[model samples]
Target: MPAQPDLRSSEPQRGGLSATQQALDAQTALLPYALAVFTVSLPAYVWAGSHAPNAVWMSATFAIFAAAWAAFYGAVNWLKKPEAATDLKMRGRVQIFCALIWALAVGQIAFFADGAGAAREPLLLTAVAAAVVVIFFASPWLPSLLIVGPAAAAGPLIALFAQPETRELASLSWGAIALSMALALIFNRVLRRQFEMAAERETLIADRAGMVEAARRLAQSKSDLVATLSHEIRNGLTGVAHVLAAAAGRNGRGAPSREQLSAALDAANDLISVLNTTLDSETAEAGRLSVEARPFDAVNLLRDLVLLNRPNATAKGLELALHVSDDLASAKTGAALADAHRARQILANLIGNAVKFTVRGRVEARIEQTLSGRIAIEIADTGPGLAAEEMERAFEPFLRVERTSAGTSGAGLGLSLSRQLARLMGGDLTAHSAVGVGSCFRLELPYDPEATAEREVVQAEVSTTPDPADRKALRVLIAEDDGLNAAMLRAVLEQLGHHVVHAVDGRRAFELAKAIEFDLIMIDGRMPNMDGPQTIAAIRALTGHGGQPPIIAVIGGDAEEAMDCTAAGADAVLRKPVSVGAVARAVADAISAGRSEPENRVVA
Candidate 1:
């Protein structure tokens, strides 16, 4: 039976290939050289034997040589296999065995030829030629040369040394063997060096290709980002500007109806969401994303998102429903300690995605508490689901699964950012889907039983909605760069019965604050002459009572901008695309916080 190849010879070397493996490759590449030599030499030996005096012995030697060559050929073919070729030790053994067989065939001719004087020169020359050929064949693996080199020369050297008259021929053969072995070692080094250089060149080429592909992908990503943002922002702003123009009677039209305003609000909110998601993704990539964790009713938040997304679902002719687990509903508390705003954001994204993708079937939002005290929300949709590969790619930033006809609208950041926000709050977001069935996205958050119990009691005592009329109207000062934004702020504040004073920039606002005692100061983060933080710092530096009013920073950038405002001693921060309720809440919170911590200041 053929010997099985050694499967556990050694570990792989650099580039995931071993020296033995490389040598095997060289051996396979050089096999044709051996075959060519054998093809020519066997016929030449047969023709030479026809004229020799001891033609019988010559015929026997030729038979031995031919048989040895045939056996070597078979072994070389077997070694061409993937498993057998890499075994350096096995190939070395085969080399020694084949060399011994050829040595024996040559020794028969050297020892038993008829005329010693006539054969001495030719026999010595034959030994030298065999040694050279063996050296060439064994050069791929150095260990094989150690035995094959000596074996090829041993027979001729012994036969010549046995005759007293031909000691000189033996010395000549010995010198030839020594030179051939030395040259074999050098040739082996050259062969290995050439192989290494080729491997390195291939590796460098591969690396260059990889880098080029990565750069191309990056450029494509940038282009896609620019195109998506341009389309979404233009559409959103067009809706908002049209609504505002109609409401202000700029087109000589009556006041816009409630539904038109709501549509505009939705467009503006969608635009804000895209911007916020992009910022959040960047912050998360920088490892600086944070969450403001507090106790809130997660079930109620989910229900609110369902209601918020119902319009979109209805427009798509899809049924949207919310399901609460029996345990959670009976307990009357599905509270969680996390960033409530972030929770709302994540649910809104999931629900929005479900509604957008589902063509005609239903979208369901299910909330339940697990036995391990974790809250899980599942957003399942009867949409054309994603395959395994697509599902995996769905959470990659800037990637969108657009297998449906619902045109890709908005930046592809919803799932990626939602997952980041989920994990930041000690939770995770995952999905399960089949290609034609549907998709279900699960969002899990760490649950606090104590928070749930506390939330139930608090919910019973405190109303989630606050009345703006219950508080005393404030003298508010607004520092805004845009005239339209300033007008909107003034209108919202005045409707809540607050006296409004508007300044075009931070410098003018600062002058007004020094002249009059305002109840609250609302400052936009970016303005000419002075930014939000600079103005806040300058105001807080005042020695008189002018800087004592509650100051709110209206940030339109990222969390870093809010941090800057906080560091500059702002009482509170209000993000842009703000609503009337948000403004009123910010005002009330700033006043309450100012009264509680009048000397609170963060050094910048």
Candidate 2:
């Protein structure tokens, strides 16, 4: 037969039981003692009444038992109080006192058997048996065995010692005492095992509950992700469809202009940007998003953002204004260290949402430095303000508020992502509004006044724009796996008067570069056969290669991917789906920089 499993190894320690359960067990184990004291006193009173010769002695003994019983009952009630349950010292004292009382009662029974002769031997033995039963049920196992075991044996032994003729009764009493002791030991082991099992069961239940809660949260997160994704996809597709339909209408009437085509392309790019932002938000939620701290002009950044959204505001027939406080203007230097790109993204989201929701009145941006040397950018809008309940849940992801006016709908990630980005910069975003009143969203962030002067000196020599006359047409090689992206790059490059060649994969691009002398090589970070880095390494390894033709890496909007490409010898990196202007600028910079210094690589 197989050996039984050891329960002691698997169960929690005996002391691991909860405080409430331990108190309850202690109460349960002591209850029988409380009742036994009162019940056992009745026989003593009856014996004192029947035996007149020793009435005073019996009465005194009965009185003493009654007093002890009263004290014991009072102690039990005292211990039941909530505060008393935690008093270990008091509980120990009470247990000891009760044991003494039990011993004294056994002594009284033995005395009666001796004084009443052999006639009371049977009665005395019966009293001893009753005491043993009470002890077993009333007290914990260890105490019961120590106090009652000897008491049971002592009763009959004393009777036999006083009356030698009662030998048979004494012998039977000894057998009963031994049996009682064995039962007590078995009961203790069982009671301890049961308590341990109860503790283990409680722990298992708690762990199961925690797991259920975790699963519930995971399910909710997935549901939110699905809903947000669907909403965003539908909105993006709808915008693209509208743009295409408008362009088609213009084409049928006469001919669609360059502006019409540009508008359609811009709409498509905006959709891609939205998808990228959603991905970035998910990365932030997973605690994997990285923030870059660099010096930037906060005042100019805010002005550009406001200017960019001015067209949208104008189309809505609403006034858009920028208000910089006197203190900020006087400070002269607006440079601060922060994740400027992320900060701009957050501000843009707020301003865009404000412009979209407000049909009339004005949208205003206010920039100021607080007394604590922190920058505060507040965007206030005269839109249909949010209700109290709506404001409470305004920053919750995927939760969209119903507006009274008609406007473009979104996946409701803008505010949530904005708030997270703001907090990530050691600041916060807060909103205050009432129904029918204008709403204000404030973003506060830490600032460094000392960086401003140095930033101004640096900015003095930097050129914001490149001279168009200096732009040169060059032979550009494009290696991309996506057909649409490849076509777009070719068109954008050709429009700028640059000769273009397309390669379907990294290996094919490497083959093309070897066959022809191209001015610049543009490779996608991910492709078939070889990736961007592998292709870059292979090209650089060519014999007599002088790094003459700079390599440009086109990748998704992941910072890590961009960095990887730069580390792998790419001259520059442009995130997709990039604009025509962005691609043109990158190509021009790569060519110009290569001409100035043949070995130089520009990392963007």
Candidate 3:
């Protein structure tokens, strides 16, 4: 059994609940202490009232004690009860409101003590007062306390000074407050420093964790790359070696019949298929993928993909089916130019995996839009299904599971790379599987808002295969800045049977176009002086050269980048390092289409 993955995850939100809950619990635990402060101070008010000489003074004293009792416990219970837990902003606001109340309660006791006929004993409230002093001295909000406590005390303290008879003997009280204020200030300064240190520590810890995650992800990508390379090289070389070895063994023993040669050829062809697929995957992963977004029918692409996969499924004796929503069909039929190449790659991975795995039952693919506004593709395979363990592991690199009676062949990089490719195209791939119920993989792509067709034309003096009557007898001009690439194309094109000409850049290609009549013009997308598109646009503007050569663009970067190539004037684009056959075919098609009257011939 493969190792199980822990799926519970943490959110990257600020002031997360863990920290807030901790602070709340600490505040709550101090509730009993707050309650005790007012409770103890009750007796202090009673005694002071009894010692009062007049009814007014005695009543004043009584109200002071009651106020102390109510205020202190009110603060306690407020802190104890849970506030708006989900609202961090509200918690902050509550902190300020409660702090203000604390200031008011403390101020009343300080300023009105002598006015309310003086408490005879002040001992009851001493412990809590001292405790509060100790806690607030080093509290994170100590600096703020200096302003609040003093601000609240200032108003009534001024009035108290005017009323000499009531406040004249409160010398000790004034001195104590002045001293507490001084102590609070010192404590606050120290707390500010500590808070700074703690904050720095937290930031350092977070940075460290971020670095660790980055490292882990890099390691995973590297391993994935290695696994992909391993699968490609090992599979290709192994197949090729076996074919050669079998052929050699047969010849050494006895001359093999027609059957052996055919089998050997078939095996060799399989290796070529693997090599092509692997190269495509590598090119994509290496960020060398080229795609042309022309309004092609999505229905057509889907049709081709289904037809290609159906035979494989049939051979596996697994039912294959497809259902494309009408909306999806509408979106596809010459409505948008998407990275249809990438879409095909994604489908290939899905169907390849499906056919590989299922021995009986069925593998199905469905493409439609969800109510949430997304293109959803679901590929489900009914094989032995996936165990809970294997389900998570299935998408991981090189993570092949033990087959149940019958299952897929090869390493498990297909799904992993496929999913990565999906995400790169602004989509997601997800899987659902149970032990005995098979697996369903879903891919969703945000619909492309702009589904414009690539209307640019690619014409070049393309080389043709060895055929006398239809050999490429036309002159083709090649424009490029790179000496080596120019030389290579000259050789490659001449060998392909097309007469080849050369130009260093746009100016040169333009001059050549004017000076000579060429059947096709090959343009490099990125040229120093005048780019292929600019040169082509210039050539089209010219009055001479009544016959416009077809233009084929050779591009190095993402061909799907519409801004670069579409506006660059490419008739039809081919990715960099153009193969002889593809170049020939593109050229044949362009010329056969007709090199008409100085039409737009451009390449970027």
What does candidate 2's lDDT look like per residue over 5-102, in tens digits?
22123444333564334434564466665567448657754653355356576677567767767776776677667865565444545555555565
The TM-score of candidate 2 is: 0.67
Write the candidate numbers in order of decreasing lDDT: 1, 2, 3
Estimate the lDDT of model 2.
0.70
- Per-model TM-score on C-alpha atoms: 0.65, 0.67, 0.63
- Which residue runs of candidate 2 sit more than 4 Å off their true CA positions? 1-270, 293-295, 325-337, 370-373, 404-406, 449-470, 514-516, 541-548, 588-604
1-604, model 1: which lDDT tens digit per residue? 1233343435424344554556656756676686677567655545544555676666677777778778878877777677665566676566556555555555565554424345555655665566567667767765556656676666677877877877887787788778888888998888777766666666667677878988897787667768778888999999999999998899898999999999998898789778877777767866888786677788877877787778779898999999999888877544787877678778878888888778879999999988788999999999999999998778877777666524646678888889999999999999999988899999999887666522221111111335655868789999999998888889878877899999999999988888999989999899999998999888888766788888988887466787888888898787776667677667766887883563332111
lDDT of each: 0.74, 0.70, 0.59
Ranking by TM-score: 2, 1, 3
Clashing pairs in model 2, backbone N/Cα/C closer than 3 A: none
Which segments of candidate 3 are over 4 A away from where they belong? Answer: 1-162, 166-190, 193-197, 241-296, 314-321, 324-338, 361-363, 372-374, 402-411, 420-427, 434-438, 446-518, 521-548, 556-569, 576-581, 592-604
1 against 3, candidate with superior TM-score: 1
Candidate number that wins on lDDT, 1 or 3: 1
